[model samples]
Target: MDATDGRLEAATVRARVATRENIARMNRSERAASALWPVPLAFGLAAILVARVTAVIDSRDALGIRGEFLIRDPDTALQLASVVASGMLVFLGIVFSTTLVAIQLAGSQYSPRAVRIFLRLRLTKVALGVFVATFVFAVAVLGEIRTKSGSDFTPTASLTVLVLLMVATVVTFLVFASGTARLLRIQYLVERIADEARPVFRDAFTRAQEVQADRPAPATATRVCTNRSPGVLDAVDVADLADAAAAAEGWIDVVAPVGGYVATGAPLAVVHGGGGGGGGDDRDGDQDVAIRRCFLLSNERTMLEDPAFGLRQLVDVAIRGLSPAVNDPTTAVQVIDRITDLLGGIADRPDPPEWYVDAAGTARVRMRGDTFDDLLRLGYVEIIRYGAGAPQVVRRLHAAFGSLSALGDARHHASIAAMGALLDAAVADAMPAPFSDLSGHPDPRGLG
Candidate 1:
């Protein structure tokens, strides 16, 4: 390539593609907290530091007769510290083995998307942190053991703290084991997934209900295209983008969906009203920088703003269960219970706002949102397609539709009725006429 083209390509590669949705948030990984090592590493560092202070404290005679402390003799104390250090290595092995097994079981029993749930547990991380911390603290305490003036000296206080930490790690391991076992259950996984999605839906609904400015699209517009790599359009910082538009005396039309993936060099947004800044001015440049800063990208879509993703996961689990290899219809029934609860809340606010405005109530960005019908279809269509033959799944879906019908929002009625019609047709396709009638009954437990 020519030198000029090479320089241009180099510049493009150096350009910032996207900004983080929130710097302080931890949903930046394949799983929560990203890696398991950071927490354990932090704990290990703290253990070394604490071991020094504890050693110094135990060296003095102030802590209620150092001789009567946990262990007194230097040789015996070293042996005990050695035991703890060695034993903790075993504990670490067990933790890793158990965690891997649990993760495998969850992935095989449920959807692969559900595997992240095990990694997201706070207790599991804490257990690992405590295990590594205890091991490091014990190793540090060994250094404090020595013989002075013919008598062996022991860091009694450090030993005592190490013992307590060892106990905590044991307790944590037991609880982690139990939590992992429970996580394998389909009901728990789907319920937790649905619970996480509810607040996202409510936030989206509340934002949509709020009034926005009635600004018009400008005759002449500057289309802001992506200058770097691609990622999921996680969250659009609307208020900030609107402020950028106002600074340039322009309005923007955001040509992206919040949860969809954007391709490289795609249109990020279109700056309308000419930014009111003269050509080649700093104000126009400032608006471009602000727009770039506002589009937060993530490695994976999170529960922060993407409401449909949760339903997508739940539907994934249900449909997989209904597959011929699994053929576990009751699992889908449990998922239907969760879906019904979410749909009930969604029915209350079926339409989310497409326009976003600045503090002064001027429209600056226009982005599209899924309609009620879209979500309903997303939540039900695949399940209906795979689960039609199962009476339990069909009954539970019918029950879900009937419950959604009671919601006050008249807008949801049409979608609910349409899905009910689709469910009935799917049932007809699955079974002969007279027997298919049996699946029409709405049973909360499907059979019960």
Candidate 2:
């Protein structure tokens, strides 16, 4: 079946079962009442049928009443029997239908439109039946009550009362249907496609810009941290901009805050004036743009596709096409990038089973007992986790190396070269692309 049909059938079946269960749980009085319902309905129908047949026979004068017995007119008897039977049927239908509706409303996938439509269709059928019955009864009443006084006749009070009852029933039906229709329409809209109210992200940036604009000068600082996404071209470009700004001007507008993560293609800083500050500009203008770019880039696009590409790989990609034109092209840059990728792969490959956030809030993968300590002593944490790849013999390489920032600044060419060679082989094994071969002529004017 189609989705809509499947849903409707499932819902109806669920409602029916639940209603039956509820009936089973009812009190003794309720159970007795429920049991009595069908008996009256069946009796009513049988009485109606017998009365109809008796009426025809008596109206034709085929059945004669014996002497000493009350002579009952068949027409009157038939009318009364029909009304009783119909009323009983209507009452039972309403009770059962109402219970069913209530059950459907309680279940999951309770579409008010579906409920309303069903109710409306059934109610409409009932209205038609009531209308026809009322018309027939009105005609019969008029015929039976009519009296001629010199060719003029007036409706009896009873006839007037019957007409009023019909009007009231019609009015009630119309009012109920209208209210239900409106309610269902509202419920349908709410269930299907209501928009959630929330603030737009752009407003926050606009407000920040407004605040900066109001001030004569805004405090700015540039600190480079790891980049988070290495895949997107835009992120690499932004990183290139930040690096050039930092190298040329001794600072960048935006840099990774310590312990903060950078996403791919996100701008490193927010320049205050215009889209970008002018070349050969003063420190104030450059710093403003750089700092603003930093904020702008802070909200890196979340990598839903690749959760493993974190801050370190992002920095590597940004610095991937670093200038061969510079005096000291840090091999450490290439080495660190490749090593980070390799170690990140290894760390990500094995499931930790259970891990915890350290005091610094960095996620530390758990090991069974002192395996983690042994790995640290072997400099495996730096190699496998951070991809630092410093010498294993140097106990407490972390303390000796200091922070990533300090480690980047260390004057040890021997360890750096060794790390670079080892990282090259590891990276080759892990990645499709080799890091040493990644070098190419970068675009002039920091375009790369």
Best by TM-score: 1
Per lDDT, the best of the predicted structures is: 1
lDDT, candidate 2, equals 0.31
Residue 166 lDDT (model 2): 54
lDDT of each: 0.75, 0.31
Superposition error at 205 for model 1 (Å): 0.8
lDDT of 1: 0.75
RMSD in angstroms, all models?
8.8, 30.5
Flag regions of model 2 displaced more than 4 Å. 1-116, 119-122, 145-157, 183-448
lDDT of 2 by residue, 147-186 (tens): 2444332223323334454575557457545744443342
Error at 355, model 2, angstroms: 40
CA RMSD (A), model 1: 8.8
